[model samples]
Target chain A: MTNMALYKREMKGSIKLLVIFSAVITLYVSIIIGMYDPELMKTLDGFVEAMPELMASVGMKADAATLLGFMVSYLYGFILLIFPMLFCILRGNALIAKYVDKGSMALLTAAPVKRRTIAFTQMKVLVSGILLLILYSTILEFICAESGFPGELDITSLIMLNGGLLCLHLFIGSICFLSSCLFSDTKYSIGFGAGIPILMYVLQMLANVGGDAETAKYFTFFTLFHPDGIIAGESQAAVSSLILLAGAIILYALGIIIFDRKDLHL
Target chain B: MSIIKVERLVRDYGGGKGVFDVSFHVDQGEAFGFLGPNGAGKTTTIRHLMGFLKPASGECSINGLDCWRERDKVQANLGYIPGEISFFEDLSGTEFLKFIAEYRKIGIQNRREELLERFELDPRNKIKKMSKGMKQKLGIVAAFMHDPDILILDEPTSGLDPLMQNRFIDLIAEEKKHGKTILMSSHMFEEVERTCDRIGIIRKGRMVAVDAAASLRERHTRSYTVTLESESAAEAFAIDFNGMRKGLKVTVTTKQSLEEIFMNYYGGEKHDEHGAV
Candidate 1:
């Protein structure tokens, strides 16, 4: 179903970007975990009360009774979402659309390999990239929390939170991959691939602001991930994660089929 | 049986912009030249043979297998050099070749090494930093390294210097001698005249002519412009030679080279327009 040589080539080509993103995200996770002080939370609550709308709009809250809640409110709201989304958008576009747009796809297609195999290999590269990024942050979070405030974080809730985060990113990466496959031009691929996810993140933020803006969540895929609910180990979070995983599978499959059937102008 | 075949292949891109009712075949161990000017659907037709495209109507097959349905099987014994050569820019030339070898599961590196030396391509430099001619040489090496039975090359010598072009033409001639079936699309008449057994000239998505290379040259009548001292003398000379007279010039047709015949096919309508005026 996939070509291992192509998989290795793609993985090698994208490894630098993955490493850079992983390092940056893990750094952010460590810093956030390190800053999980109850005294600082009390002070932050004072500012949160002063600027409730502004803080809420960014998915930030100082109302945390545990280390995991503090981490979720600070990191999952923006840093975690934006960084990995950037990786997905850029890496996804580079995986397929970049080669086609630059006319290098002819080299691959000229080989005996099927188009389906090439697409499948690229998908594996992308999916693995997202997994590694999420996994790196998850491990770093554990290491940081255990060393800094041992036993302060709930093991089950933290696992559930990271699981939901993984599913959400996989879904976002698939959206980028589909758009990448749909357009033969990088500008258009990046435009829609990067555009849609960033839009969803903004909507998620606006929905978090509460009141009339709450309906905006319905329009965004990001709403499927409720960091607070996942941290509380809600069944709804698990179902939403499953839905995200399902959507990712469908989008990836559609991308592969479309690439196999489309006419390549290369 | 034909080693490669296209039966009434039609891919309409609309507004008369695509190949229409295009048909041709290459027998085993024959070199067929596909000649066309820019935007003449040369690459479009070749794309179908490579199975990168499905024809709107009709079909293309290689070794009796449908090109589109069994592309992988077809490509297994086929090599292709696309009109535009682009590569993985980040990889060094050596790395790209190794990658292709691994991708194709080629165990023997002898042919690849020989081609690299013949082309004088230093695979040490990153492809992004290499010159266009170097990249072209790399494309040629990668396409031929597998030593496939069928080779489809589009403008294979486009960016090469005259020396390298001659080398490529010689290479094609040698490959033809080895009984490789080659379908080469080119704009250069000299290379085709030197290497191809037959030539097919395509213009405006239609095959204007397909004939033996030697016959296309032999059958074409060359046009010459004879200058006289006066318009009367030119008119007198034109009548004697049964040529057209314009001022002090008398145009006569004699023997044409392959280049002129190709020009006639490509610019035939424009030439007729000028004659009408």
Candidate 2:
């Protein structure tokens, strides 16, 4: 019940940020598509050629070239990943470290609630908030698609893609939650939480560049949530995404267990 | 029956800090004060009682329910006001209070309104804009609004004005009359002296003494300032007073505590300068 309350609060606080980001990104993409209709194919070709480098940089897949693939790669790849990463870091940092930093945990912990309940509620709030953002972004994407910009994208496939992104966000959220448990300082929590995902993103890109190190893709969450893999209808990446999602749950559970036993100073 | 009990509760920080093997008990409906100097483990003990930190060894229980294992059930019966009041700055006082009430699964009802009025808190204001006293009042209101069976407060009056502190004392007195158990941790000796029935003094994380306030004062060395008609009488009384007790020290003084002089001067008066006798 406490978790439910915290989740509601997190969602309430972040809805505006999520809505604004979604509208801005969607509107920007729609305008670009409308103004440069003649150069659309040229731009699409350039985007495809740059896909590998872009994917390497952002830990996305290089194969998204078709209309559906372009939308997923352009919209979901860089924008979706960065936005949720920011949200997860912000939410996770606030949940535990912020409370400790501000001395509010003393007030909360002084209540009859257990430390584990507090930690668990925070994780729940963060994950739920990320889910809300994902839902909003997916709605925006659908709206933009319906407005006739990307005519060939399938709604069902887009839903599945968003679902995969949701799992990936959960993965990142758990990582951030774990970092929060490890670091009592808010600055350290945000730094470490945001740093790890970006570091993993870099690692995945390096592995892609090596080509022979294909197995390294399994190590990073970004590789699992790659837009091209989903658009290519590769069941393997879907399975990998599920595995990463499971890993996230396990990480969060581990954090909760540790937090339950650890002494809190607030 | 003891409403709160701690038996040799050890909470050691990795570097050998915090409370170590400290133990005490508070009977039901008792207003217990936990007195300690800074870093004397008062907050540490309170945290253990709240189940925020597990005891390194031994146990802490509330109404016979283990605080660690039965946390939610134990917490459901508790109202807590922390030493430091750090609320969600963006939320209005009412919003923050409502959020807490919702988590506790209770309706604010009239309790919220009553507390706000009593504390003179404006619930409409954002928490960030409120003064420290106002913030403290908000915390007090939130904690008390639930009307829990037990209140575990840590320096609850740190930021309150003297008038508000007096009101808080009266509130605690009222709560005590209604048979609510209170465990208050504070460095404010006078407040403890005024509000608590029993006082526990902890020094360096170990409980130095735990007894009824009057009894502890009596058992410990009492200070008596005697002002005689002459210096000879004052010197004679000091020697006699010192000889009567093993460790007692007596001092002859020309000056008296203003409170003592005021009481003596106003004795048996029907009307006083302040309009009360």
Candidate 3:
């Protein structure tokens, strides 16, 4: 059984952040929907023909002028990746490292619960916030599409895209949370928590730089969730899902192990 | 039985900066004051007792449970106030108190409300907006609201106003009467003298001395100047009392004073100067 008091406090503290993140994603989806003018896809096709390298540099497909491809490049490609990843990195740090650095965690650790219990409850809150963010964005995307661009979206692809994103962010959050649990100093926690994720993003970007760069994809977690393949119904869900689940599990386990045994030095 | 027991605890942070072979005990219903200069291992020893630090050697226990391994069970009967108080700044004072209460699982808030009123703390203000003294008051309320049997307070009156400090002294006295075990670390000699049954002084990560409060007070000697009738009378009075005679005045000092012993024990500057010489 979990601690209800801790759960409630964690929820209350992060609810405002949760709302803001969800709003950004939803608003972004709506704006992208507004960009659709039915014939704009043809215009995009012409523009892509004019400068193939411009679209290719950002990993946008030259032929993706349909609703699904437009959403993939404009919405998922940048906004979803940057905002949610930043949210997870920052919130994950705040949950553990910030408390320890500010000495507020000393009060919580002095309570009757074991340190692992506190760490576990905070981890759950992080996961719950990510899940809720994805849920709200997915729902709003559906609503925005139906109202503004009815019959434009492919339902399966939309679900697949959100599902893949959910897995990816969980993987990101777990790594950040683990670093937070391992170090009592915020500098060390942030150095690893934010540092590693940004590195992975860069590796993925460099892998997309046209030629021999594609080999770098193998070194990044981004290769696990392929957006282009996901939209084309060519994604290997079992393999990607397993990697994400395993990464999340191992990282969270490491966090609990370290937090439970390590001295907080309060 | 001892409510808190620390035995030969050693935590070496290197550069001679950690507690070394420290040992002490606090019995139930006794007030023990821990006195020290800054970085005298007082906080480290207390952290060991609070189960916040895992000792490099030796161990600490509370109510017969190991402090580090059995912290969850040990904390049930303990109340603690750290040297520096930090709260969730976004929450109001009332919200923070309520959060502590819920964590403590107290169905009735009779004691909580009583402490709030006693401290005159308006709990509606956000924690970030509260002054240092008010924040210290909030820490006091949260620690005592649980009404635990043992209290570990570090520099508990540091930021308090004079009146509030007196009120806090009175509160400690009341708790002592109710058979509470308290281990308080402080720099205020007056407060320590007023409330503690025993005192321990630490210097440079080591305990210098521990003695009963009454005995220590008795050991502390003060020189008195007595104006005699004349120089001859002053000399005669000095002979009678074995005092120092200076014209019409005679001076006498108590022997084997605790303050003298304590001062000598924490003489780091003297040690450094001697080394220099």
Candidate 4:
């Protein structure tokens, strides 16, 4: 189908917000990292041990017991997941729910486009916006690393970590898309969109802290893309990330199908 | 051929309210008006015809194609202006129009300039900055820009000034001349009387009447007020009028037109009391 028009329109409308958000996040992370002097082993040790708990809360891993590991864990665990999720929530809320809420869906549904085409185009815009944010964060990470912090910057591992994070974000985006299709109210869509990830994050944290419920970790995309898991060279996490990414694609497909068949009243 | 047909269409909003078993047809090149007061299911009927809402029972078809089953094809042949025209506030009017044009895959081809001049709209202004009437004008222009075979307008002139309303009527007339079918839903009786070839009056989720405007007026029971020179004369006239009545009912009273009563009680200079006296 000729769905590029909607995709282009959505992309143009959302890219500016994504850029501004990424810039703000990068600046904030840079300042936090700048305050650390990684040469102090005692201070570094304290930071590392504390970092794992923080990462765990943010749906990251607690296995990173070193400065670099802590930094990667924090970045991957909290910043990466939280930022893109916020992006997804905002974009997803606006995509379907906002149109329905504002009665603009009447106009769109009356046009020559199919409902599937509309959903797919919205997904394309969301995925593209998220990918751009990932790209910006990766570039910013490298720039921060080169700013002469006293730690060994493992560029390859960081790249892999961010790549995994991107996959997780894509999964979150799909979740948001599905939720958006399910809800007609934009506020409710956003609530569920952001809430689902946080719920998963909490579940993962509980699985970690509760010890016996580690199996629950497998249910979350965050668990699959944990930074410490990747740093420890655990192939399981990488495999799981791939599986979750596949799940994301399936969710997005389902969202489009549901949108197509369901009645859209405006 | 009928460009639009709705048969036993039932749409419920889950709260026990919506259009129920509504059936109507709009022939090719006809200006059809769906008229009702507020909460009369007019918008609901239009929404089903546009394929935005699926009927709970029965069907809606546009140009002989099922609206729900053959949506894309049906929609391609129609232009629609919704009741509420909210746009992406961040985009300029030019950008919004360009986006729609691209989607429709039709070049503006001087249509933009013509419509802009006709509506006095500035293409450069962001949608958020424009007034409600300006936005409505933009929607009207966008709906017509592609020059589709049918135009479905819901409350098209709600926010327009009298001048713009006249321009809108003229635009519809032009479309009619070009043989474009129109299905318009509105609450304004005068507009329906002025432009529609046929009208369907919906009340309480059912079509109460559908006929030519003149026929509707003729069918409606009208009230007549008759004033006599005196109360006794009024009583006598009332008895005579009742005996002579064909359809209209006449009420005889000492009541006078406010203007005439005012002229009698508060006499002023003829020029000052009434214009061009």
The number of the candidate with the highest DockQ is 3
* Number of clashes recorded per candidate: 1, 1, 3, 0
**What digit string (tens of lDDT, one per residue) describes model 2 on residues B8-91?**
998776444578889899998899999766666888888788777778898999989998778778988899887667888989
Candidate 3's TM-score reads 0.90
Candidate 1 structure quality by residue, lDDT tens digits, A1-266: 88888999888877898888888887788887887887777777887899987887777886877888888888888888888889899999999999999989988988889999999899999989888888888788888999999888788888888889889999999999999899999999999999999888888878988899999989998889888888777889889999999999999999999999998888
Candidate topping lDDT: 1
2 or 4: which has the higher DockQ? 4
Q: How does residue A222 of candidate 1 score in lDDT? A: 88
Instruction: Give per-residue CA lDDT, model 2, range A208-258, as digits (tens).
Output: 665676666767767777566776778997897788789999999988887
Tens-place lDDT digits, model 3, residues B1-277: 8988888999887777778888888999999998765666888888888888888999899889999999988888888999888998988999999888887676666788888888898989999999999999999999998898999999999889888998899999999999999999975555687899999876666777788978766666568999989889888889989899888989987653334455666543532111000
* Best of the candidates, TM-score: 1
Per-residue lDDT for B1-277 in model 4, tens only? 9989999988776444678889999988899988766666887888778777778998999888998878889988788888777787878899889888887777644777788889888878999999999999999888888888899999999889999999989989889988999999887667876789998877657776788977754444355675556766666666866633222434632333322322333455131211100
Evaluate residue A8 in candidate 1 and report its C-alpha lDDT on the 0 to 100 scale.
Answer: 91
True contacts kept of each: 0.87, 0.64, 0.83, 0.85
What fraction of native interface contacts does model 1 preserve?
A: 0.87
Instruction: Give each model a TM-score.
Output: 0.91, 0.83, 0.90, 0.83
Model 1's A-chain: what TM-score?
0.97
Report lDDT (Cα) of residue B99, candidate 1: 91
Off by over 4 Å in 3: A36-38, A46-54, A231-237, B223-262, B266-277
TM per candidate, chain B: 0.83, 0.80, 0.84, 0.79
**Model 4, residue B50: displacement in angstroms?**
1.1
State in Å the error of residue B229, model 4.
13
Greater-TM-score candidate between 1 and 2 = 1
TM-score of 4: 0.83
